[model samples]
Structure formats: structure tokens, C-alpha cells
Target chain A: MKIIADKPKLLTETPMHYCPGCTHGIVHRLIAEVLEELGKADNAIGIAPVGCAVYAYRYFNCDMIEAAHGRAPAISSAVRRVVNPDNLIFCYQGDGDCASIGMAETVHACMRGENITVIFINNGIYGMTGGQMAPTTMPGVKATTCIYGRDPKKYGNPVHLSEMLATLTGPAYIERVACYDVPHVKKAKAALKKAFEIQMQKKGLSFIEVLASCPTNFHMTPIEAMDFVKTQAEPFYPLGVFKDITKEEANS
Target chain B: MAKGKVEFREAYCKGCSLCVNACPMKILQISKRTNAKGYEVAECVDMDKCIGCASCATMCPDSVITVYRD
Candidate 1:
């Protein structure tokens, strides 16, 4: 008589608009589950960014704000500033939003050590815009713009956002987890839950980057996209906790 | 009697087949019938064989699958 896999109460009943096989919905569910588990669903404030997940405001049951592209970090920081200090505030952003257009805001927020959680979805393409090359796109990945495959010498290399942000002293937690497999999906949920926990502790800047699959953009079957995420993406964007200041604080 | 069960919100399934591939029991498959959303949805062929591993639910990006144990 136990409920095993019901939808999280924090997730709205609204059906998602993400493409089939897109991993954004899984991430959304993970975050919603975390919010419900922490008993912060009602107190949670989510900032939705412009990209594939722009409609996220309609999906999460908590109060949400639609922030300008790449400005999600800035708006989230401001929300964290004016809102009840103990309330949970987070940003849901894509690679193009967080690493490309919002790169400065993202980096600055981490530098300032803003006590906010950033759920970054790195699918390595401009998914909503028909699969263009993104800042996080792999060096040799083919996209609409990079039909010939990404060129390191011409277009530069993929930006390791988690690794870059981890170098800053401001972030209390940073982790990169993928959603292509069961074990990794479970790990992703754990990472997201830990990020929220860090925010609750008033630990500054918790960033979790999820390497998601884009089957439509990748022009591959859902299963093949999962394989691509494992074989190609993981080699470039290795998974694991990049930083956890709570551990450092405990050890010290 | 079925030992386990799984239900798919057909309207939400994008017919991605992730669940069909993830099901270790090999009891799930894409249905020929499309849902209200016009995408083929996943369907379990044999509820009796389900182990309740929930792998289909875990790999479903749409969160359309829900599993239950009896």
C-alpha cells in the first residue's frame, strides 16, 4: 500500500513541453522532489531562464519568475536578497543561458557567494533554437551551426562551467551529474538535494550542472542519445563533486 | 496475479522508447496506438513478469511512467 513512484507534489500537473527524450523533465522532477522532501515547496522560489526550459515556470508548483536570458543568476541573486533569507531560491538555466549569455552573471554570483542554487542543464546545444553550437558544445560535436562539427581552433573549446565556477571561493557546493542512466540519474537527484541543502544552510552559491540528453537535436534515438552522453559527453565533462565547502568547513 | 505494475500517462509520453529499452524484463514496448498528444506511448506487455525495478520509470525523461509493487 506504499506509493512507490508517484509524481512529486511540488511538480505542477501541467504536462512538460520538452521534446521526447529530452532530460529537462527528469531534472525538473528531481528538483521538485528535493523541494518537497526538504519541506520547502511552498517557500521555494524558482527563476526560469530563456532557452529550452523557458516554460519551466509553468511546471514547478512553487512561485516562479521568468527571468531574461542568461540573467537568471542576477535575478535569482536579487530574489535571494529581498526574499526571506531562509527561503529557498534557485535558478533553472541551460548551457546557452548560463555559460554563454549569462556567463558573467553566473560567474559573478559565484564570486559574490550568493546563497542560491543554480540548476544548470548542459545539453551541449542550443536545443530550443534548433540545435546550434553552444558554449558547452563539445569540440567536435555536430550541430546546426557546426554541421562540420565544432572546431577548437575556430570556435574555441567547450567551457567547463562547473570546473570554472568551483575555482571561486564563493560557492559552497558544485557538482556535475548526468541523467542518461539509472545510476547517474540517482546521483543527479542526490546532487540536486545536496545543493538545496547547502542553500538552506546559508552556504553561498550551490551550482549543479546536469549533462542532459538532447535526442531531437542530436538526431539520434533516445537510447542512442543516452549512449552518446555516456561515451562522448562524459569524457569531456567528467562527473563528480567539484566542490563542497561544507566538507571543508567540517574538516577545519 | 500480477506481482508488480507500471502505468504510463500516455498523453505525456513522447514515444522516446527510453523506457522500452530500460526495462530489464523486456515486457514494455511502444504501442502502435498514439495518445491524445499524438505520440506513441510505452505499454507493458506482461504485468506478471514485472520485477518492480522501476528502471523504466527512472530512464523516462518525460516522467510519464509510474511503477508499483504488490
Candidate 2:
């Protein structure tokens, strides 16, 4: 009980408005844990996107900027260049904000080797926009936009963000993780912390995409949602650190 | 210490019985009452003997268990 209160320096005393069992809360906790671990809460600046985490400005205790739909990378770039170089910059976005609307900005930001960490939440459904299908929406998965399930013919196949981004010549690190359960959630925490560490090393841009759950829109109870994500979604998305500047540094 | 109480939020549980059999105390039984989602769940009668091992929470496919330790 005591440990919970003193947990993270990156979050505020205000409670989250996200629905119960929504991975937004877990994902927020992971970022806070990273801030506390790195002792950068004082100098850290976070950008909140226009999705479910748009309310993140209230939850995260660090200096936060609410960006337009999918424009977090652009905002982060401005902050990283104009603001203190020693300051840690971070951006939080969902699939719609990152993979779809912000793809152009995100890709360009990474190619420029922007020194920042991007926390991407891939729930496959547009949570804030009423569960519309997203670029990462799995094939055959039903969404509000795709009443008959996503089809590669019309909608095309799901975009694999990490794999695609890893092909880029810039980003210092790129990883994808899950927030569905304890083990996977812990792995996500470690991955987020590593992204910050990558940034600290001036290793250029780092990205971490977390597979989150939209229980209300997914039409699943909490546990059922967990099961669906673990068994069905994990096989499709997978999880791993695709690139590591430190590992590359050790070799090259 | 007597028995501890196990509270299950049926809405949060996914009907996975990993907790029902995980209790080594053998004091747990499945509840006949179905939730709004129509999942047959577990109910603990002899909570007095519960050692608070949290085996149910660990084995619980759903993280809906709140164990009160005595």
C-alpha cells in the first residue's frame, strides 16, 4: 500500500479517467515507472496524442504538451531542438495517431534522427473515435468501420510498424511489447526504460509500440479481452526489440 | 488465523477456472450463480482456512481476485 503511493514521480496525484481494464492505465504506469527509474521526471517532457491517451495530460505529472491528431513527432522535434538538449522528450500516440495520420511526420522525424522516445499504443481500433478500424487492425478482425472484418482486398493487410520502421536507416532503437498480462507488462516496462536509455545516450530516435486493449469497443469483458489479446492478437503482432543502438554500439 | 475471504468480480473474470483448482486448501467451490455475461464462476465457502497463498489470483486467467489476508 505504501509502495503504491510513492511509486512514480512522472505521474500526478489526479486519478485516470480511462475505463477499468483499459490498457491505457497500465501503459501510463509503465511510462511513469520509466521516468522514475531514469530520474528524469524533472526534465522530462511528454507529448499526448489525440486518442484515448489525450487525457494523459492530466495523468502524467511531467511537463506535457497535447498535440494535434497524429502530430506528436512534429511537436517533439520542435521541443527537442529548441528546448534543453539534456531534457528527455517523449511522445505518446495510438495506432490512428501514429501508424495512420502521423505516418508521414513520424517517418520523417525518425529519418532526421530526432533525439526523442515515442510510445506508440497499437490497440488496432480507434478507441477515442468510436472504435473505427486502424492501420494496424488485424485481418479478419471486426471493427466499427469494418463490420465484416478487415480484408486485405479492400482495406489491405495490417501494417507491421516495428518491422517496417526497423528498415529505416535512422532510428536508434525500435521495439514492440504487450500490456495484456503481468509477464508481458513487465517486459513492456523494461522496453520503455530502454527507450529512454537510448535517448539518454544521444542514440537518436527510439520507438516502442505497446499492444493495448480496447475492452469496451472490443466487446469483451476484462478477462476475455486479455485472453483474446494473448491468444489471437499476439500471434499476429508478436513482440521484441527490433533494433538497439547500444547493441549496435557494442558491435560497430 | 482463521479463513480469509476471496472476492471475485464476475464482470472482470473470463470464466477461466485456473483459480478454482489452484487452491491447495480445497476450500473453494464453483458458484452456481451466473454473471451478466453467463460465465460459471468460483465461490469460496471455507475462507477461514484460506492461507492467502494467492494461488487463485495467480492462476486466475482474469485478474479479478482480491484476497483479504487474515
Candidate 3:
């Protein structure tokens, strides 16, 4: 039999620390596949964030740095400037890190249009910290902090980070995708590959916000959590390309 | 009549059932057998039903499933 699908060589044999059915693993696999396919797996540097994927450095079979909480963007920017120009740099961050604590870093990185890729996972609740309410937590969603369900008046509305970042002129591409199913997973992989390609072309930042699920924290089965991401989360944070300079150029 | 075969790295399987749900052919199921981690593992009940779509592998968060086509 011929192999139709197999694990990418860029991923270490270490089992991921993410909970069962966590979409983070899928995203990690996609990044590894993209890097390997682009022939940059050997020359890539990844910045692991301070969230549930804090040990991400151990998973990707490449040089990795553990960035302080919400500081991955800052670290990535600095690394991008000093690393070999051919080296591919990317940062993996969660909603709590990217949209809440590191909001400034994320915004400035986009505003500067750093030639790097940022994979943002927006799972609504803060998974690493026991499902606390995050900046991206949808209104009325129940979390540890907002156990009674998030009140828009008290917690304010969820942050539309991708849309906000897309407004910046520095970024070359910005898109939001989900991986609750096969078709969406394929699209997310395509978007991730495009992000890496854009960075290789010396284009500005390419930010991809992926809607993920937290089965353990959400107190739901893996499949149910995925359905929640599809029926509940997707409606609030619609999936599509928020900005794409190449598309704009093609249109113009 | 099997067009494809699926193999599971049982050690890495979390038995999340994502592959079971993603299998369009409905041939995947969570087996009672537990892995070293004590989580149940997924198995293909009927290889003949597999169409080599690789949907199960694509949805498997742990990347435990590998697909091959005849």
C-alpha cells in the first residue's frame, strides 16, 4: 500500500500535552506539514507561548524559544530581525496571550508588519488557567471566572482581534479559520501554508486566527466541543480572510 | 473491495472518537482495548468501507491514524 497520509517529519515523537480532542494538536500538525512541505522545516524557529501550549518547544522538531506570557510577538519580531533572513520564524499564541495580555505586542507587531507568521488560537476560554474568561470569550459563555455566563455589560464584548489587526496597513495577510471538521481543517492548512509562503516572499506579517475547542475545560465530549466551535463560536467570529494584500492587488 | 487501509499508532491514540465521527464510511469505532495511557483506542471495524478519503487522519488531533491506499 502507498502512504496517503502520515505524520510530518517536522514534528517530534513526543506526545502533545494538549487535552484529548484539542484542536491545538491539529494546528501544530498543520504547521509542521507546512514547514516540511516548504522545505523550511530544518531552518524554522518557533516561539512557544505561555498558555496551554507552553511546552510547544518540545513538539516541533526545530529550534524553539519559550516566550514569556503574551510576549511571543515581541520575541518573534526581535528574532526575525536577527536570525538569518532565510530562516522561517513563527509564533504560536492563544487568545489569552495574543488578544488579552499581549494585546500591545500583537498590535505593534502587526503595525510594524514584521516578516513573520503568527498562528493565533482563539478557543474563547483560557484553557491553561482552568477555563477562565478570556478577551475572546464570547458573550454569555460560562467560564471559571464567569461561571454564571459572561455578561456583556460586566466583561464587555469579546475582542475581534483578527478584524482589529487587519485594519493595520503593515500586515500582508490576515485570515480566520476553524478546524472542527475535515473541510475546515483542509482550509486552515491552506491558509497556514499561504502564511509561510507570504513570509518567505518577504511580505509583512501573516496572522491566522484559528477557532479551536477546549473539551476538558468546556466540560463536553471532544465531539460536542467541536460542535460548539462550529455552532456557537463560528457565528460570533465568522471565518474568512479579513485582509489579503495579494487578493487586493489581484482585484485592483 | 477495500480501497484503503488505516493504521493507528495505538500508543498515541487518545480515543477521542474524532476519527470515528469523521469517517464518512462509518467504519471507525472506539474499541474497548486501552492503550498504555489507559485511553480507549479507535479501530476500523470494516476496512472494505474505507474509501481512502483520509478524513479520519485529518481530524485526528493526536495524529495517531495513518492512511494508505491500495
Candidate 4:
């Protein structure tokens, strides 16, 4: 028998601590597979954010650093300058860490065209903090802080981080993808591969915003949370490549 | 004979059922059996019906399933 599919070697034997059914696991697997396929598994450095994936350092087999809350991009920037040019640097961050507190760092990284990859998990709520409403929380999404659902009038509108960053001239690639099903999962993996490839080519920053699900915090079954991402989240944060310098150059 | 076989790393499975839903052949189901974590693990009810598609493995967030084919 031939093995058609198995776990990526880049992922450690250590079981991930992400909550059951959380989409973070899928993202982690995708990143591992991408790194392995790119032949950069040994040369990859990951920056773990202060969120549900704070323990991410345990799962990835390569070098990993735990960055302070909303400081993953800042740390990634420093790592990029010191690491070998062939080495791949990536930051894994959550909406709370990337869109809220790390907003300035993330935007500046893009503006500076830092040659690194940022995997942003936008789960709409702060999963590690008991489902507090996040900066990317959609209107009418209930959270601990917004028990009655977020009110745009009082809380302001959800921030579209990818779109905002795409407007900058620094970033080389920016895309929004989701993994609610098999097809989307495949697309997400493809996007990750492209992002890493861009980084390896010494292109500018590549930011991928993944619309993930927080089933445990959402008070829904895993399947139900997947449906929520497909039905509710997708509509608000449409999926597609927001920016690609290669495409622009070709068009020009 | 079945065209494909699937294996489960039960220890790593979180029993989210995403793989069951992703199976195009509809042969996967959440079993009454639970892992050490007490989560109901997914099992292939009819291996004969598997088409060697890795959809289940792709959709599985925990990477619990491995697919093999002759």
C-alpha cells in the first residue's frame, strides 16, 4: 500500500493544545505542510503570538520564539534581519494579537515591506480570553464583552486588516482565505505555499488572513462553527487575493 | 476489494466530525468509541466505499486520519 496522505514531518509529535475542533489546528497543519514542501522545514523560524496558540512553539519542529501580545510581527522583523536570507520567517497571530494590539506593528511591517510571512487567524472572538469581542468581530457577533452582539454604533465597525494593508505599497502579497471545508482547505494551503514562496524570492511581506472558527468559544458544535464561518463570516470578510505584486507587475 | 484504506491516530483525534462531513462517499461516521480524551472518534463505516480521495484527511483539523491506497 502507498501512503497518499499523512501528517507533515515538520509538525512535532507533541499534540497541539488548541481546543478540540478549533480551526487553528488546520492552519498549523497547513503551515507545516507548506514548510515541508518548500524544502525549508529546517530553515523555517516561527514567531508564536500571545493567544490561543501561545503554546505554538511546542508543535512546530523548527525554531520558534514566543512573542509578547501583539508583538509577533515586531519580533519577526528582528528575526528576519538576523536570519539567513534563505531562512523563512513566519509569524502566527490571532485577530486579538494582530488586529487589535499589534495593529501598528502589523501595518508598519507591511509598510516597510519586511520580507517575512504573517499568518493571521481571524476567528472573530478572542478565544483564549473567554471569547471577548475582537477587533475583527463582525456586527451582531455575541461575545463576553458584547453579550448582546457587537453594536457598530458603540463598538465601531470591524477592521478589515487585509484590505487595509493591501492599500500599502510595501506588501508583496496579501490574501484572505478560509478553511471551512475540503475545497477551501486546499485553497488555503495553496495560498500558504504562495506566501512562503514569495518570501523565499526575497519579495516584500506576505500576509494571509485566515478566517478561522472558535467552536468552543462560539458555543457551537464544530460543524456548526464551520457553518458559521461559511455563512456569517465569509459574507463579511470576502475571500480572495487582496494584493499580489507579481500579478500587478504582470498586468503593468 | 476496497480501493483505499484509512487509518486514524486515535490519540490525536479530537472527534470534531469534520472528516465525517467531508467524506464524499458518506462512509465515515462518528463512532460510539471514544479516545482517551473522551472525544468520539470518527470511523469509516464502509471502507469498501472509499474512493481514495483524501478529502477527510484534508478537512480534518487535527490531522488524525491518514489515507492509503493499493
CA shift of B48, model 3, Å: 2.0
Off by over 4 Å in 3: none
- Per-model TM-score (chain A alone): 0.98, 0.96, 0.99, 0.99
lDDT tens readout by residue for model 4, A137-251: 9999999999999999999999999999989999999999999998999999999999999999998899999999999999999999999999999999999999999999999
Q: Write the per-residue lDDT of candidate 3 for residues A1-252, one digit (tens) a residue.
A: 899898888888998888889999999999999999999999999999999989999999999999999999999999988989999999999998999999999999999999999999999999988989999988889999999999999989989999998888999999999999999999999999999999999988999999999999899999999999999999999999999999898999
| TM-score for each predicted model, relative to the true structure | 0.97, 0.80, 0.99, 0.98
What docking class should model 2 receive? Answer: incorrect
Residue pairs with clashing backbones, model 4: none
- Per-residue lDDT of model 1, residues A1-252, tens digit only: 344776788887888988888899889988988899899999999999999999999998899999998999899889987989989999999999999999999999999999999999998999989999999999889998989999999999889999999899999999999998888889999999999998998978899999988988999988899899999999999999999998898899
Best by DockQ, which number? 3
What tens-digit string does per-residue lDDT give for candidate 1 at B1-70?
7667898888788898888888888999998999888998889999889888888888787778888986
Better of 1 and 4 by TM-score: 4
lDDT, candidate 3, equals 0.94
Candidate 4 deviant stretches above 4 angstroms: none
Candidate 1 vs. true structure, TM-score? 0.97
Q: What shift in Å separates residue B9 of candidate 1 from its native position after superposition? A: 1.7
- How far in Å is the alpha carbon of A136 misplaced in model 4? 0.7
Report the error of model 1 at residue A201, Å.
0.7
Candidate DockQ values, in order, are 0.71, 0.10, 0.89, 0.82
Residue A234 in model 2: lDDT: 88
